[model samples]
Target: MDFDRKQLTNEQLLDLYKKLLKPRLIEEKMLILIRQGKVSKWFSGIGQEAISVGVTAVLHKDEYILPMHRNLAVFTGRDIPLYRLFSQWQGKANGFTKGRDRSFHFGTQEFKIIGMISHLGPQLGVADGIALAHKLRNEGKVTAVFTGEGATSEGDFHEALNIAAVWELPVMFIIENNGYGLSTPTNEQYRCENIADKGIGYGIESHIIDGNNILEVYTKLDALATSMRENPRPVLLEFKTFRMRGHEEASGTKYVPQELMDMWAVKDPVTNYREYLKTEKVLTDEYDEALRAELKKEIDEHYQQASAEPAIEANLSEELNDVYKTYVFEEVNSKSNSENVRMIDAISQGLKQSMERHDKLVIMGQDIAEYGGAFKITDGFVAQFGKDRVRNTPICESAIVSAGMGLSINGYKSVIEMQFADFVSTGFNPIVNYLAKVHYRWQENADVVVRMPCGAGVQAGPFHSQTNEAWFTKTPGLKVVYPAFPYDAKGLLATAINDPNPVMFFEHKALYRSMYQDVPTDYYTLPFGKASLIKEGDDVTIISFGAGVHWALETLAKKPEINADLLDLRTLQPLDMEAIFTSVKKTGKAIILQEDTLFGGIASDIAAMIMENCFEHLDAPVKRVGSLESAIPFTKALEDQYLPKARFETALAELIAY
Candidate 1:
């Protein structure tokens, strides 16, 4: 059969063959290393080289591609140094992740490659973010993300595709249908005859192609990417192929049928492509053999150099250093002009001021755009900043948060709001796994602020009334800020947005319209890790944040004779330990209050820290006041009893008297 190069020249055709053969050679070498115990593990992409190579060949250098564990050619085809890749595989200090993660779990921003998380589906939403950034900037850059057929069952896949289609962002949702996801076959994965048909539900153009055929893969992607760049829109391309190996080297392939393996072996992409190149006169058999030899030599030399590099040192401080970006807080001038503003308006003003200052700041939520959000915090934002800056997302928390991380990847700051804090559970995986760990793992900051309206008082039931700040305070890489007053709310929010780390900004829904304060009219920022001294006295110390601050104040106002130090811990993650210890030592008595339930609450941690640090200065035992350990009831009467308001008042009285 005569080879039809189509629009590709002879040089391009030969280059594709070289790209296809390199990963196959690299995988073969890696398998040997695995057996020799030089390499720990590998997700071999032996038979599936054509999909990554052909797709990467069609993409521009500036365009981004998020590759999964099985897409090794995407890295090699992009001309990333072999030494660096080998260094990563060998757990060397010179690797992309500094030996923090194994296999292809790390990404390099220089190469425009976003590595996939183990979840397998969140990267699709991240692709939506990168594509959104390109669309927002009119960059004409396209993003391609890969996933196996089994990951199609994930909600993130559907959410990301729906978001990309709705926004008309230039993205290629590449599904490498490699027969099985781990041990489960594609037949058990989904009911649809073709994964491409799932794209129809999302309004995205879909196609199924012969993934083993390099010419078909390259030609189709080239035309599709060209059209997408010219007129931005998302499309789905399902590549029918087989995984040729186990999920990982250790898993083994006993679950796969013998006939299936034999059938795919004959249709091997690398061997077939090599034979085609020879038949087309692009290379002789001798030249092909020489090329393979040269590539093997190069891989061997690179591996040797990488193996000689130093391994990661076990330094405790160094290991903890890059978890968050160091932020220098500029003290706001206290004498700045002030005006009375509600907590909601204060947050709105802070967001408005931030949007005005940072051109790249984007706000995303379900009803935030024209609907003004659930609390009406951004009532007129869409009218002022337009829809692009204030994007209304679907009811997909996982995708929205993942997209926020994506926007941060390309030098943009994003603020993602959960309608109510309770709904954040839907977005929990991305927040804890990807957003929190990206900086620690790869030295890349996911500069995102997730505004969670938390706490209970309005009888909104179990779902909407959760005070889940404790959920993330235990997370290492995230910064947790829960403000009590309008002044602190505005200032802390400004700081959270400016800081180069993921922040969980908890806004108590009960405090939105209830509290009013004289806040700074102009832009200002309050430093984190500092507690706000709401009131100063000498008898007892009351430590709290968010709605607990108000309850403490109410209790303190009623007891004029009982002088107390009211400390509003503005940020939870960067807990004001110094302030806490100082107040606890001075008073020699402390009562920690929280809106969350008593068991496993942040208040318990605070109480423990107080006892640990201020054990010597103990006039009385440390006391904790929190809501009952039960789901927040829907009735106002039960809610009042369930809340910590009465409990806090009693605890403060007992502490003062003791």
Candidate 2:
């Protein structure tokens, strides 16, 4: 099993010790940063560094690396700068996102850390994508993705593994079994004895390794990683590791049972590696002390430099480049007013036209090819395009997105349809990490479009009909668009297909069947980041997007007391801040609305914009109309109560009355 396993030389063993030590030191330093008010919070990679470095060292440099939040060792070994790493934790101007992005989404393409996402299990799907790309390009590289034991229980973990096994993808999935998901032990969550054993259903080679033993992790992972690269098949490994420190900055170990705490305390990966080196007579005290001091000095220097480093100033003018190439989006502010086209028909026409225009464009998803998508947006594509391009996929959200990204990386315009937007959560990682990040990391963009039916009318209940747009709005590098009228829907969707980036094109299921404004016969596309001013007025600026725009319009029609200026951000990601600023400036009032939950939604960003930049221009406090922070309910009555309604007519009156 271990073809290349060798007895480590004294120097090699010393290197393992040092690698393990770096994580512990970095984690502790991060804890100090958290306490000193330098960084907000962090998850420690303390007891799991050996597996990360050892496994990565075995894989080829061109091979992909997808690691979860707790594995900074992958970033460190892959050569992600310590300054950028520490700056990410500090949440300063120099932070990973200029303090705009989440903390654990670290690593970059420069490191060949293919894609990194904080959410659990999703990395497995992204690894599938990287492997698929390797297969297509005839490359002998493997894709290595890591996850915690808890991530193994996720639907994405199973979905990705199944597809990789089916395709025999060149992938080595390593489960970093660090004993717990926060405080809940693996035993409490998963019924399986071992995460590796769970791979039996997928019919892939799997192994369990002593993750605390650097040699074991290195030898086991190295063989599997090499085998996948050379032979090009899927393999799975479970690294039995531990967590000596608390889970994250928020976790205090207050809930950990004293018995299990004592059980794992002695097996700390860093401590184990240090002791193993001494026992094997591999390292001298002098070499060890010098290495420790050098690492400490390096850490201190990088922290100071990164903390003080100026933010990566992206020119606002250049922000357009970050979203789309100038040629893809030609500014044409006029909404289509020509005769005769229903909303659903417009969507179908748009897809057909785009696919016909670009030979690279292909549609795939459950029932998409043959049945023509859940709502028939892709009707007749399979018959015309052939199964190779318009093939139907098995019902696996993770695989759908990951595979689409793979196709996109190799110059394919992949369009995936989630049966409903609420169901898109299953593929959230691939959308955010691979589809969204490939361009930023490798400086190469993907033309991937995900058409998800969203919104909460027609009473389809919670699971089938709930708006989940903002779930994606939180993630950068991905465009989220929601169109109200048939013309904008068709135009925006067409624009998204042409753009060289991932787009969450939300087709409101509620509006899909509704006969709205007439669309033009001539195929046309609306540019990204431009909003439609439905009614320009100086009374109250009702800033909205997607389904909310229609709702705002209807409310304005019925009420005489208020004349609202409606701005529909047809493309959510490249938000038209200029339009927002102008509207708020003139109207001297802002009321943001959407069908998603109020807490942590995109409306918050709009509110923050108003408060920070346009505070002096506002005559009244900004108002937001959205569902209360809770899961969507199943019953019709509860569903009505869960969404942001135009029935908030009284609320609008109140805003204008102020």
| Whole-model lDDT per candidate | 0.91, 0.76
Query: Which parts of model 2 are misplaced by more than 4 Å?
Result: 1-18, 21-42, 92-95, 101-103, 114-118, 249-297, 307-328, 331-346, 352-362, 379-391, 398-413, 421-448, 453-489, 500-502, 506-524, 528-658
- Residue-by-residue lDDT tens digits, candidate 2, 1-658: 1112286566666666666777677877888888888777777777678788887778776666877777778777766668878877665555444454556664455566644555566667767766776775578887788878877778888888888887788888888888888888887988888888877888998988877777788876766766666788888888887776677867777777788778777777676666656665666678778888998999999998987776566567654355433344654443445777778998888888788888767677788877888888878887887775676777798877977765665456778889888788877767776667655543557678888888777787768877777778778678888888898888888888888778899888878887566777657888778888888888988888777887887888787667778888887787898999899999998888878888878888988998898899999999988886787777778877777774456667888889
**Model 1 misplacement above 4 A:** 1-3, 332-336
- The 10 consecutive residues of candidate 2 with the worst lDDT sum are 319-328
Clashes of each: 0, 0
RMSD of each: 1.2, 7.1
For candidate 1, the TM-score is 0.98
**lDDT of model 1, residue 555:** 85
Candidate with the greatest lDDT versus the true structure: 1
Candidate 1, residues 1-658, lDDT tens digits: the string is: 1235797888988889999989999999989998999988889998899899988999999889999998999999889999999999887887898778988898889999999999988999999999999999998888999998989899999999999999998999999998998999888888889999998898889999889889889999999999999999999999989888899999999999999999999889888877887777888989888999999999999998998887778878878988887777767655578999899999999999999989999999999998999899999999999999999999999999999999999789999999999999999999999999998888889999999999899999999899998889989999999999999999899999999899999999899999999998989988999998889988999999998988888887898998889999999989899999998889888888898998898888888888788899989999988899899999999999999898777777777778
